[model samples]
Every structure is written in structure tokens, then in C-alpha cells.
Target: MREFDYERAADAAHAVATVHADPDAVFLGAGTNLVDHLKLGITAPGRLVDVSRLPFDEVTERPDGTVRVGAAVRNADLAAHPLIRARYPMLSAALLAGASPQLRNLATTGGNLLQRTRCVYFQDPTVPCNKREPGSGCSAIGGFDREHAVLGASPECIATHPSDMAVAMAALGATVRVLGADGEREIPVVDLHRLPGTAPERDTVLHHGDLITAVDLPALGWATRSTYRKVRDRASYAFALVSVAAALDLDDGVVRDARIAFGGVAHKPWRAFAAEDALRGAAATEENFGAAADAELAAARPQRQNAFKIPLARAVLVATLRDLAGQEAR
Candidate 1:
């Protein structure tokens, strides 16, 4: 709606340098999220740096039994990859469970992870949103909050990160690789995003001029046995009220390992470290799963309209674990 300058990023350094040089510049991947924000008037970047043409839209197999997904890799391509479908079914399932076919075809991997919240007030420019503008106040706190976060919410904002792919990546322990003016470095996907705290405006820890190149997933033995379950209102094209991405390693009917992350319930992907710890040496049982889910969600702070999310998240976790019972967990 507003007039803005556009620049096509020529190279990796240029992409990083461009944004760093211009504080008002944004690196565009697929224009799915950025364009939506621009149309909504939520974001008014002075310059749109088109990074979609950068050489980061690739999915390469690494020698260390890992898969490297370039930031610009389209969601559809990542979901349909033979390696992703076979070895990382959870990631593939999570990817396919999001948006629509047409949107997925244009949404890039990094863009998906960096997508903004879907909170009603945040999207509505007429309302106050601390995330959209500092000190504007959060309308969701006292307004329609049925779809807001229950866990890890802040006084400034209760919006949840809308990304199924990110939840799966957090569970899979994927490493986010970035290249900045300072050079290249890696951050765990889970750590890349932080609690809203007081800085509700800052969604991620990525510094200015830092470009997320790819996400590298190291081989975790139980990856293939993983699955993602999403509970939403109408099923298709709906955001998750609560979603679970889980992978388990069991030895002789006893739990050997587990990784669990939650979506649509927190400021970012909610990694159920408490649940994983509780399930580590416990026998795979309904009661054990229930207890683990409870432990992880025990600290959840709920508002008036969305307390149901805690139980819904617990039920999804219990069911996902049940489906894996007695199977040769990959």
C-alpha cells in the first residue's frame, strides 16, 4: 500500500551488506510473508531486498548423514524431497500440514520459519499491537485471544509463532546457519528464537545484515519414526490450536530417547524438554506419556478463553506416542 524501494540481492555478501547498510531494508525470500505484511501495512520497510534469487534455494545431501536445506528452498520442494520423505518424515509431514498447495509452492524454508504471528489484533492495523509498533500496547491481552499463546507468553504480547516447519525443526534439533557481515556461524534452531520478554518486537536473534543461508539437520537415529499431529478448527488451511512434533527412541519396549516440540501454543516453537526428560528411561505407557505431557505443560500460563490448549496439547502428545507403540521405531 505504501511506496517502497526494491533491490535484488546480487550475492551473499551483498545480501548481508545491503541490509546492514540500510537499517530499513528487509531480505525477501519468497515474498509470501513479507508481501503479506506489506499489504497489511504492518511492516513498512524502506527497501525490499530480493534475496529469492540468491544461491541459497537448495537442498543438498551432506556427507555426514545430514541434510542441508537452503533458506530459499521452496516448502513444496522440501516436502517432496525423496530424502526428506524417507528419512525425515516428521519434517515433511509438518511442511505439508501448513497453508495451501499454492502458498506452499511459493513459500521458502527460511521464510516459513520467519513468518509472523496470526493474532487478530496483530494483523488488524486499527488495533494496538506491541509487536507491530513498540509501545503501542498489545490488544490481544484484553481483546479476542482465543488463538493466543498459553505458554511462555509475556505481558506485552501473547501471539504465537505460526510455523509447523519450525516446530518440527525445533524437535529435530536442526541447526540454523547464517552468514553475516561478521562472517558465518550457527545457532540451534530452538535457540535462534527467543521468548518475547519485553522486546515483543524482536522475533529472532538474527542480527542486522545476517542472512540465514540454510538449516542443517544432523542425523538423529529416531528421526524416521517421527510424526507431526496438528489440531485445528476445520483441518485444512487452518492454523494449529495445538500441534505436536515428536520422535522417539525405544529399546526393548522401554523409552531410550525422545524429542518433542509444540506449535501454536507459545511465542516460538515450544520444545518439551520437560516431557523428554520425564520419558527418557520410563516405559512407553499411556500413563507415562500423560505424566510427561503434564510436566511439560505444567508451567503454562493460560488466559480466560484459551485454557483448553493445555489439555489439547497434552492429548496430542499422548496420541502421537500411542501410535508409535510396539513399532520398530526406525
Candidate 2:
């Protein structure tokens, strides 16, 4: 809708250099969310550096049994990959549970992680949003906050980070390989997103001119047995009210290890570290699951309309943990 220049990146170096040179430039991968943002006036990049055809679309498995997904790999292709479907069913499930098939066919791995929030105020230009325009003040604090955050929220803003893949990736302990103007660096998936403390505008730790090259997931034994459960008002094409991605390793009905990450509840993926600590070495029983869910939700500080999210998160976690434990939900 707006006038903009575009070019296909010749290589990674040229792309990074171009971005560094022009602060008004943005790398274009899938263009699903970025294009929409552009049309909505949420973002206006003077130049679009297309990197979708940069020869980084492969998904490879390493000798150590870990998997490395190219940044430009399509969500549909990645989800349908035989190795990913068989090894990381939870990821596939969460991917399929997201936007429609057509969108998934165009969405890329890096773009999905960089996707913006779905907060209504942030999308509308008339509404004052700190994320969209810093120092403009956040209108969601006292207005239409039913879908706002409950945990990891600040007085400045109460928006939630919307990414189903990021939640599953967090549980998998995935690492992102970034190639920036400063060279290469790996960022843990958990540390990728930032909390909305005083600065709610910065959603991630990514620096300017940094291009995410790939995502590396460590070899996890629970990948096959993992489950991702998302609850929403409507089943199809709906964002999660509270979603849970969980994987476990138990010995003789006793929990040996647990990985839990929550979506649609916080600024970043809620890992439930305290809950995992409580579940470790504990019996895989209904009582233990309840205790773990409670421990995780104990820190929840909900607003008027969003107070239900705490119970919703708890119920989802309990049922999801039971599903992972091969127990019937109550």
C-alpha cells in the first residue's frame, strides 16, 4: 500500500551489510506478518531485502542426532517432514494448529519466531500502544484487556507474545544460529524473547542487522512422546487462550525429567521452571500433576477480565501433563 524499494539478497553477507547500512531496511522472509504489518502502517520499511531464496531452506539432522532447521524453511514443509513428524510430533501438532494450510505453506521458521503480537490495540494506529510507538502510553492497561497477559506483564504494557512454535521450541531447548554484522552467535530459545519490564517495546534480544540462519534443537528423548495442547473459543484458526507444550521422561512411574512451556499467557514462553523442578523425581500421579500446575500458576497476576487465564492455564497444564503420563484426564 505504501511506496517501497525491494531487492533479492545476493548472499548472507550482502544482506547483513545492506541492513546495517540502512536503518529503514527490513529482511523479508515469508512476508506473512511483515506484509500485513506494512499495510496496517504498523511498520514501514523503506527497503525490503528479500532473503527467502538465499539457499538456506534445508532441514538437516546432525551426527549427534540433533536437528537443524533452516531459517527460511516453510512451516508446512517442516511440519510434514517425516523426521520431524516422527521425532517431534508436538512441533508438528502446534504448527498444524496455527494459521490455515495456505499461510503455513508461506510462513518460515525465522519469521514465525519473529511474528508480532496479536494485541488489538497494537494493530490499530488510532490506539496508543507502547509496543508500536514508545512513549505513546499503552491503552490496553485499562481497556479491552481480556486477551492481555497475566504473567510477566508490566505496568507499562500487558500484551502477550503470540507464537505457538516458540513455546514448543522453548520446551525442546532449541538454539538459534544468528549471523549478524558482528559475526555468528547462538541464542537459547528461552532467552530469545524479552520480558516487558520497563521497556515493553523490545520484544526480542535480536540486534539490528542480525539474520537468523538456523534453529538447532538438541537431541531430546521425550520428543516423540511430547504433546502440545491448545485451548481456544473456536477450534479452527483461533489463537490459544492458554496452551501447554510438555515432554517428560519417567523411570518406573517416577518423573526423571520434565520440560514444560506455556503459550498465550506471558510476554515470552512460560517455561514453568518451578513446576518442572517439583515434578522431577516425583511420582507421575494426578496429585503431582496438580501440584506442578499450581506451582507454575502461583505467580500469575491477572487483571479483571484475564483472571480466568490462571485457572485456564492450570487446567490445561494438568490435563496435558496427564496426557504425557498416559493418565486419563478427570
Candidate 3:
């Protein structure tokens, strides 16, 4: 809605330079989320650096078996890539379980990672949303908050980060490669996103001019036996009420290692590090799985209306681990 200058980036360097030169400039990948925010009046950038045609659209497998996913790669292509489907099935499943086919075809990997929360108040300009205007206050805290966050929530904000791909990547221990005016850097997926502490306005740790070029997924051999389970209000085209991305490495009915992350329950992708720690060397049984889930969710602080998310998250975690354990048995 706001008048802005648009520039097509020649390359990654050009894009980063353009954004760095202009304080009110943002990179344009697929424009799936950015455009919506523009129309909603949530963001009004002075310039839009088009990075859709940048040389970052390939999905390649590295020599060490790790996967390198370009930020400009389409979500559908990433989901259907052979390496992703065969080796990192959890990542593929998470992508497909996200938006519909048309949106997925248009959404880019980087854009998906940078997607904002779907909190109703945050979208409405009239409401008080700390994410939109820090210090104004968070209406979701006491309003209709069934979809708000239950973990890592602050009084300033209770909004959840709505990205299924990031959740799976967190479970896979992926690292995001970024380029900026200074140089290039690799930020762990877990560290890329930030909690809604005092500064709920800042969603990620990225600098103003940082450009995410690619996402490097470490070799997750056990992820082949992984699963992404999402429980939403509807069957399709809906955000997760509680989702689980889990991978279990089992050895003779005992857990050798585990990677677990939860969505729709936290400010960012909630990595179940405690749960994985508890599962290691433990018997692959329902009781043990439940215990691990409990251990990870022990610090969950649910709100008045969204307290159901706690039990829902626990159930999803237990079910996902059980399903993966079953696959290992087969």
C-alpha cells in the first residue's frame, strides 16, 4: 500500500549491499509473507530488494551426506527433492504439511523461515501488539489466546512462531548461512530465532542487513526414521495446534539417540533437548516416552485459555516418538 522503490538484485552481494545502504529496506524472496504484511500495513519498507532470481535456488547434497538448501528454493521443490525425501524425510514432511500446494509453490525457503506469527492481534493494526509496536502491550495475553504460546512466553508477548520447516530443521540441527556487509556467518537454527523476552519485537537474531543464503543440514542419518506430526484445528490448510518433529535412533529396543522439536507451543521452535537427554539409553517404551515429554515440558507456563496446549503438546510428543519407535522395530 505504501509507495516504495523496487530493485532486482544482481546477486547475493548486491542484495546485501542494497539493504545495508538503506535502513528501511527488506529483501524480497517470494513475497508470500512480506507482501501480506505490506497490505496489512504492518511493514512499510522504503525499498524492496528482489532476491528471488538470485543464485541460491538449488538443493544439493554435500560430499559428507549433509544437505545444502538454497534460501531461494521453492518450498514444493525442497519438499519433493530426492535427497530430502529419502534421507531427511522429516524436513520434507514438515514442508508439505505447511501451506497449500499453490502457496508452497510460491513460498521460498528463506521466506518460510522468516514467516511471522499468526497471532490475530499482531495482524490487526488497531490492537495493541508488542511484536508490532513494542511497549504498546500484548492483547493476546488476555484476549482470545487459544492459539498463543505456552512455552518461553513473556508477559510482553505470547505469540507463537508459525514455521513448520524451522521446527523440523531445529530437530535436524540445521545451520543457517547468512551474508551481510561485514562478511558471512553460520548461525545455528536454534540460535537464529529468539524468545519473546523483554524485546518481543525482534523475532530473530539476524542483523538488519543480513541475507540468508542457504541452510546447511548436518548429516542426520537417523532422521530417515523420523516423523512430523501436526495436530491442527482442521484437517488441511491450518496452522498447528501442536506439532512434533522427532527422530529416534534405537538399538535393540533402547534409544541410542534422539532429536525432538515442537511447534505451536513456544515463541520459537521448542527443541526438546531435555527430552532427548532423557530418552538416550532408555527403553523405547510408552512410559519412557511420556517421561521424556514431561521432562521437556516441565517448564511450560500455559495461559488461561491456551492451557490445553500443554496436554496437546505432550500427547503429540508421545505419539510421534511411539510412531518412530514402531518404525525402528520394523
Identify the candidate with maximal lDDT: 3
Against the correct fold, how does model 3 do in TM-score? Answer: 0.98
Where is model 3 more than 4 Å wrong at Cα?
327-330
Candidate 2 lDDT over residue span 1-330, tens digit each = 779999999999999999988999999998999988988899988999999999779999999999999999999998899978888888888888888899999999999999888999999998899999888998998899888888999988899888888899998899999999999999999999998888888999998889999999888967788989999889878788899988889888999999999999998888889899999999999899989999888889998799999989988888888888898866
Q: How high is the CA lDDT of each candidate model?
A: 0.91, 0.90, 0.92
The C-alpha RMSD of each candidate to the native structure, in angstroms, is 2.1, 0.9, 1.6
Q: Model 1 segments beyond 4 Å from truth?
A: 326-330
What order do you get sorting by TM-score, best first?
A: 2, 3, 1
Off by over 4 Å in 2: none
61: Cα error in model 2, Å = 0.6
**Candidate 1 clashes between residue pairs 3 or more apart in a chain or in different chains:** none
Clashes of each: 0, 0, 0
**Cα lDDT over the full model 2:** 0.90
